[model samples]
Target: MSTPQGGSSGGKVRGWCPDAWRPMMAGDGLLVRVKPRLGRLTPAQAVGLGEAAVAHGSGSLDVTRRANLQIRGVTEAAWPDLLDRLLALGLVDADGGREGRRNILVSPDWKPGDDTHRIAAALHDRLGELPALPGKVGFVIDAGAEPALSAESGDFRIERGSEGVLLLRAEGRAVGVPLGHGAEVEALIDLAHWFAKSGGAAAGRMGRHAAPLPDWARGSVQPAQPKAAPAPGQRELGTAYGLPFGRLKAPTLIQLAQTPGITGIRTTPWRILLTEGGMPGQLDGLSLDPNEPLLRVDACPGMPECPQSSVETRMLARRLAPHVVGRLHVSGCAKGCAHSGVADVVLTGRRGAYDLSLGQRAGAPPLRAGLDIDSLIAHFGAV
Candidate 1:
């Protein structure tokens, strides 16, 4: 149904990765990510997405920690074809400009008539009206009966209070201000204006900005700490599956749809995927087993896949997982796109070597520099 390129299917040119409209160039190929509506994919849509990836790009599709699907390793000649296929599959925004603006995350557990969907839908239609915020700056609509996006909420959050009222929260704030579900979009846009007015451009991200929230926005209730997602397996939603490092082979996903019981695909900010039904007994590189140790590690494309890295990351991480304690992050470089938060073990790649740090985030300075995977394993043994 589509054409492929001669020689290599992807390239190794890497720099600033684009979010919507255009694909980001990577070592393998061009990466085109699709942010699903409310972060969901119907079974039919999922099949189409997997096929599109196989037909036009690399046979691999990456499920980002942001709950989006990215077709990896596409050649320059194949990008346009990939765009056409994506549009036909209803996987992208026809208007590239709006595509970048429509960044809204909702609780995966939300239902049709629930506040999460209602609010998210309203905001989706009005995305063009809001002032331009940072591409990564996003909203988490967790208005489900129980708050579901405590950890996933980015700069701003619209969540439900214990009393069943809607509250708007800014990241790093201890409490949230009470608002009706009706005010979610307008209030958020106003905050964007507020953020820009307070020198948000100079100091990127809400948490880093020194200015305080506007006077009108005040703490009505203390928000709870975020809890980890439900472990792998069947739940009220469906059977859950985990990818070793959030990578899913497109052909495998295509086959997964052919299996019985599956009806839809839902993803989390984590590397977990929840389908409408149980997965077909076994899937290569996909984990139905909840306790898999590979699930504890986070990694990004390194070395050959990304120009930023000097070493291969995931392969080494996989080898080191058995020796490392708690969560591990194998970042390509200091940017730390894979795991933003701190982890027990972090190995950041730099000029073909790794900087090791304990109890630190990916971007932080390491305790020791220029260590290989063996040293990493030995560090665990020594401690």
Candidate 2:
């Protein structure tokens, strides 16, 4: 794996993410994000991904908030070879356009032929029929007995209703319309067209769009209760492990992929992975304690690793993790790629200094500014 050779890359926010066909430039090199099929990976595919990460980019992988995997530090020269390897492993979409459109997040708890699995497969097959959407628009299929992905990010959600009926929900709405058993995908396609025709593209996100949903798309049928976020430990289906700060090294991934009794792996947006049918054995770099404070913190690859960052982040976050309470987001910049949602404590980096904010997202105005790492540690130490 190549180490990051920092360059004079400008600190700017690129509105979209990188796919297998198109990568994004950063301070270290280029970044290629892989959206797995329903975030499911066979052991062989997982091993291949780790190998590719080591061979073509940096030896590190990021488990993104969208439950995708990112290979960082790739040079322009290495991207084509990496893309070929990914395609051969059956981990990429043959058509980049369809791949970009198929940004569906599945419930990791799905069984072999369950609603989550079937609906996601059907959506994948029907991707070509949907209209072009904003790059960040996505769907979440949490059709488990209870919705487990409510807090995760997505523009549209397919979840169980109060009476076990499947409902299709617009993102910002509190309720959703129930769908017939066989019509989930078709209804979804209709909604996509509705969004496009209603001028949703300008808003860029379903939640942000101002237009009211049509009568057919609105209902009072509340979604079923949400399940608790999975903690790091043994679960009925497998063992759950947390990636500290949502990152895993190539060696650790390869080890987990090769572990005995592991049938497959499921990724979640909460920095957790479920190793199906596997026991908690020798997990060298993963967190097993649910109460680990660092798990509550979100920090990006700040400074030299990310061109947009003005200061180093993870280390400072670590130092403050235990000292602070509630959810903390140490953003490298105002973009807050690490955690876009509101956090209890937010520290935005600017001009090699930190700006402190409380109970807000990263871009919100800070209560104080220009503090150094030592000052932050001192401030948190008092808390």
Candidate 3:
């Protein structure tokens, strides 16, 4: 129920949620987290998690913001057994306690031959080689495609360029590295180590620190183009849905999986669910319209659940949803736990009221309000 220290360098790592939702951690000496590639899991892997959930602390699992899966309710006694099961399913990466440091994002459609996957794999392997590095040091490999978590950014980003070269961005500044199957991947790890050693404060992500890069290190960045989504025949049907405060009931998850044509399910770091091969007519029943107010907003669990949260952020977000435009983030406190990249609008809780900001600019004048939901929505609607 306590907030773990920010970044990977701290102590007594807290689970993502409360015990009822089944929380796990890396160095906590009790619970363990299992992160899969892009949150993709085979049917057998899914079954293994279901069994592990039941046998461990609680029969529950949490889908994290980084498109990874965590099996909660794991106990000290069950760690080895659960790990063995996960390893058998090919879910566990090569590193032992280093799984938390391997945060990589790639196109959901990233296939075997793609350079993106190769680079991501190389980076992950290299991180595994550096056991001394902090557990939270991570990277993202964006293949410049849909259903990708790349837009969220990360400590390092490898974006594809126009001339078939890969553009590397570290701490936000564009750094061009030689393009090859896995050459840039090595360069990225070297950059990470250098950044860590140089006392470069990991500012939430690579892009956040990009502004300070030297001119020569600032390589040309590729223009991001919107690609037409693949047709239903070529692409699998995926539905994005959020779990209130990133917690989903075990039975609900299992039942949701039972729907026909729902072949796979992946979790985004934003506490949303992406189900692939959805039932022919399932989209109609669920409240998942992306343009809808509920889908456009996100909040951290505040108040009773998190002692540090001064207000109930999710309730406020839901109440103010109707007037929200674009993507909005509501944090219980200034920690901004729910977000990795900046949102179009941000509402941070202070005392009994709220402090709001517009656009990407930070530390502007606060739009003080009585914290009334309707008034908040009206203020945002006016913007």
Candidate 4:
């Protein structure tokens, strides 16, 4: 049998830093990931996650773009016990082996008593029973709250429509599966399972394909209500400066936890972090803002970390970050692993160089030839 890299007889593993830089290995013998329900973990859950990291695996936890938490360095022996603990914490009651398949991204500001959680729980239970569904099948439920991350980008989405209707979408297109309250949630799941078992190519996201509706259903539904505007003096915090390359040091994370009045931490799929509270006066020293260019940039690991990477994409992207606008994503290869949706700018690594593409489609042809880091920056800057 093939042993995992960096592990003895056990399954010890190692991972790369941001954009696949320096090597970082887990001291423990296992890597265990925790998926947060609806991206809302209570203060108790936060403390539990921190403790789980320090005791079972590494003293660190990674918040993934899917609104989940990952605990590295787990040992095989500790797996059952850890799962038991997590389940007891009310965070692990979903379907068997269905945790990964329940990739739902809800609004960051989802309230505590909203019906969205009830609907998510039902969908998760249903998904658990259907093991045949692809592991990447995802569902997102948005309440039209602020700091919306997965609303537009989710594979299956449920957004508020008018006062009584709830809009349902499959692959970012309206599916005409309108219903009241929790009615459409299960319908959305059935639609996803149908697509998965029908041998439809894994689009990796729902919006990648078009959803066809019956002729009678066309143009009958009204447009969804406009999302509520953010209040005055309120700004959405961007996830740019928490750390270099997406990993924050343990001490810094602890310090962030200790800050008072911090409603919570919101993690995005782009490997960025957002603080619900405004930049605290005490945190003024840290170079952070809701609109920094670095916060809007994303890159995948390249070169040393991923054996398939041909060039150092993260460093190259960082060097070019200052010249881009809106949101930019840099991938190590054509696979485009870092981003799930259309990016304003995409820099994909090629044979010892880079290729740039504009617009959101990943497979689109490059706009320019593979160029070096400096030349790439200059070219984008000129545009």
> Which candidate leads the pack in TM-score?
2
Compose the digit string of candidate 4's lDDT tens values, residues 263-347. Answer: 5665545444556663543332233554556656667656754445677877776777778887788877676656656889888
User: Candidate 3's residue-wise lDDT over 1-383, tens digit each?
Assistant: 22322213223334232221123442322334556666566545666666666776466555656666655545556656666676677777544445556567655556566766677667666666543444344676765443244346566667665555666666445344335555676667667766655555544344454345534335665534435422222234466665554655555566566667777766556556666766433332234444456656667655644445666787777766776767778877676767645677888777756778766322235556446555676765743
Local distance difference test values of all predictions, in order:
0.78, 0.88, 0.57, 0.56
Candidate order by lDDT, highest to lowest?
2, 1, 3, 4
Better of 1 and 4 by TM-score: 1
Compute each candidate's TM-score over C-alphas: 0.91, 0.95, 0.72, 0.71
> Candidate 2 on 1-383: residue-level lDDT in tens?
33222222355565666777767778778878899898988999999999999999988888988889988888877888898899999989888888788689999999989999999999999999989898889999999999999888888889999889999999988899999998988888888899999999999899999898987888888989998989999998899998888988988888998998999988889999889987797576699898989899999999888878999999899899998889999999998999989999999999999999999999789899999988898898943
Question: Any runs in candidate 4 off by more than 4 Å, and if so which?
Answer: 1-32, 51-62, 71-95, 125-131, 145-151, 162-164, 196-246, 262-264, 269-288, 360-363, 377-383
Alpha carbon lDDT at 76, candidate 4: 51
Model 2 root mean square deviation, Cα atoms: 3.0
Model 1 TM-score (2 dp): 0.91
- By descending TM-score, how would the candidates be arranged? 2, 1, 3, 4
Better of 2 and 4 by TM-score: 2
